[model samples]
Target: MSTDTNAIGLHTSTATQLAEHLNILLANYQTFYMNARGYHWNVKGNQFFELHVKFEETYTDLLTKVDEIAERILTLGHEPMHAYSDYARVATIKEDTHVSDGTTCVKGLLAGYKSLIELQREILSVASDADDEGTASLVGDYIREQEKTVWMLSAYLG
Candidate 1:
C-alpha cells in the first residue's frame, strides 16, 4: 500500500468519501427493499401474482446489495453506518408507505432507481478519479443492473 493510502490500497480521504457514499447507497437500498416488501405484502389486483413475485425478487436483490455495500465500506477501512436515523439523514431516497397499488409501487421503484443511479454515477466518477477499481466496478455493475431494471419497470408502468 502507498503511504497516502490505507492498507487496502485506497487513499485515506478517497476511502472516506467512498464509505460515505456507500452508506448513502445502503440507506437507499434499505428503504427500497422495505418498500418492495410492503408492496409484496399489500399489493392487490388482477396482476397480484406477477407483481408479488417480482417485488419479492427485487427486495431480495436489494438486500444482497445492501450487504455488499456495507462490506465494501469495511474493505475500505471504514465503519459502515447502521442506524436508521443515520440512514434517514444521509439517504436521498425517502421511505415510502401504504403503496399497495401495483402501478404506484412500480412508479415508486422507478423513482428510487433514478435517485440510486444518479448517486452511483457520482460515486463511479469519484472512484475513477481515486483509482479505486473496486468501488468503480461495484458501482458500474449496480448501474448496469439498475438501468435494465428501470427500463423494465418503465415498460411495466407504460
Candidate 2:
C-alpha cells in the first residue's frame, strides 16, 4: 500500500471510496429516520403507545447516526452529501409512504436495518483495508447496535 495520505493521514484513494460509501449510508439513514417519524406520527392500533415510543426512539438514534456519519466523512477530508436530492440519487433505501400500520412499519424498519447492515459491512471491510480504525470502529458500533435492534424488532413482529 502507498504511504501517500490525505490531510487525516489516510490514503487519499481509500478515503474517497470510504466517503462514497458513508454518503450512501447517510442517505439511507435519512430516509429511514423519516420513515420512523412517519410511523411515530401515524401508527394506530392496540400497540399504539408502545410502537409510537419505539419509533420515536428509533428515529432519534438514526438521526444521531446520520450526523456522526457525516462528521466522519468530513474528518476524512471529504464533503458529506447533504441534500435530499443527492440522497435520493445515491441511496438504495427508498422512501416509505402512507404506511400507518404497526406491522407494516416494523416491516419497513426491518428492511431499512437490513440495508444498513449490508452497507455498513462493506464500509467495515474497506475501512479495515485502509487501516481507518476510526471509521471501522464507528461502523462496527452501528452494526452491533442495529443487529440487536433487528432481533428485538423481529421479536416484536412475532
Candidate 3:
C-alpha cells in the first residue's frame, strides 16, 4: 500500500491497521458490555440499587459503542469480527466466572477500563501516524469516556 503525501489523506496501510484495531476494540466492547450486564444482575449488598443502575447504563452505552465501532471498521473497508469465538480471540478483557461484591466488581471494572484505555492509546497512535483523522478522533473520544468510567468505578471502591 502506498502512503499518502497529503497530511489529510490516509494511507491504505493505515486504514487497514485502523480497521484491525477497531475490530479488537469492538470485541473488547462486547466483553465489557457482557461483564457489566453480569454485574448489574448479580450485584448485591447495600449499594445494589445504585450500582445496578450504573452498570445498566454502562452496558447500554457499551452496546451502542459496539455497533459504532463495527460500523467504523466497515467504513474502513474491513470486516468486523462478530462471533463469540471471534471476540474471545481478540478481546483483551476477560470475563469473570464468579459473582463478587459490588466493591470487587468496581475494582475489576476499573482494571478493565485501564486496559482498554491503554489499547485505545496504542490505536490512536497508529491512527495518527496513518493520517486517519476520523479514526483518531473516534479513539480520542472513546479514551475520554473510558477514562471517566475508570475514575468513577475507582471512586466507588474508595
Candidate 4:
C-alpha cells in the first residue's frame, strides 16, 4: 500500500471525504424512506391503490439503500450518523408535507430523488478520483437506477 492509502487501497483522506458524503446520503435516504412510508399509508385519490403500492416499493428500496450506504461508510473506516436529529440537520431533502395527495407525494418523491442523484454524482466523481472503485461503483449504479425511476415517475405524472 502507498504511504497515504488506507487498507482498502484508497487514499485515507479521500476515504474520509467519501464517508462524509455517504453519511449525508444516508441521512437523506432515511428521511426520504420515512416520507415514502407515510405516502404509502396515507395516499388518497383515484390512483390511490397504485400509488400506495408504488410508495411501499419505493420505501422498501430506500431502506435497503440506507443499509448499504451505512455499510459503505463503515468500509471507509467511519461511523454512520444514526440519530434522527442528525439526519434532519444534514439532509437537504425536507420532510414531505403534502402527504396524502397522490400528485404531491409523487412530486416530493421526485424532488428527493433529484437531490439524491445530485449528491451521488458528486460522490461518484470524488470516488473515481481517489480510485475507490467500491464507492464509485455503488453510487454509479444508484444514479443509473434513479435516473430511470425519475423518467418513469415523470411520465406517471404527465
RMSD of each: 1.0, 1.7, 2.8, 1.1
TM, every model: 0.96, 0.96, 0.90, 0.96
Off by over 4 Å in 1: none
Tens-place lDDT per residue, model 1, 83-121, is 888888888888888788889988988998899999999
lDDT of each: 0.90, 0.93, 0.83, 0.93
What pairs collide in candidate 3? none
C-alpha RMSD (angstroms) for model 2:
1.7
Q: Count the backbone clashes (under 3 Å) in each candidate.
A: 0, 0, 0, 0
Q: What is the Cα-based lDDT of residue 36 in candidate 3?
A: 85
Cα deviation of 41, candidate 1, in Å: 0.9
Off by over 4 Å in 3: 1-9
- Candidate 1 residue pairs in clash (backbone atoms < 3 Å): none
Candidate 3: residue 75 lDDT (0-100): 79
Candidate 3 local lDDT, 1-158, one digit each (tens) = 33543233556567777888888888888898888889988999998988898888888888888888888887787789989999999899999657759887787778778877898899899988876778889889989988877777776677
Candidate 2 clashes: the total is 0
Give Cα distance to truth, residue 136, candidate 2, Å: 0.4
Over 4 Å off, model 2: 1-3
TM-score of 3: 0.90
Q: Scored by Cα lDDT, where does model 2 land?
A: 0.93
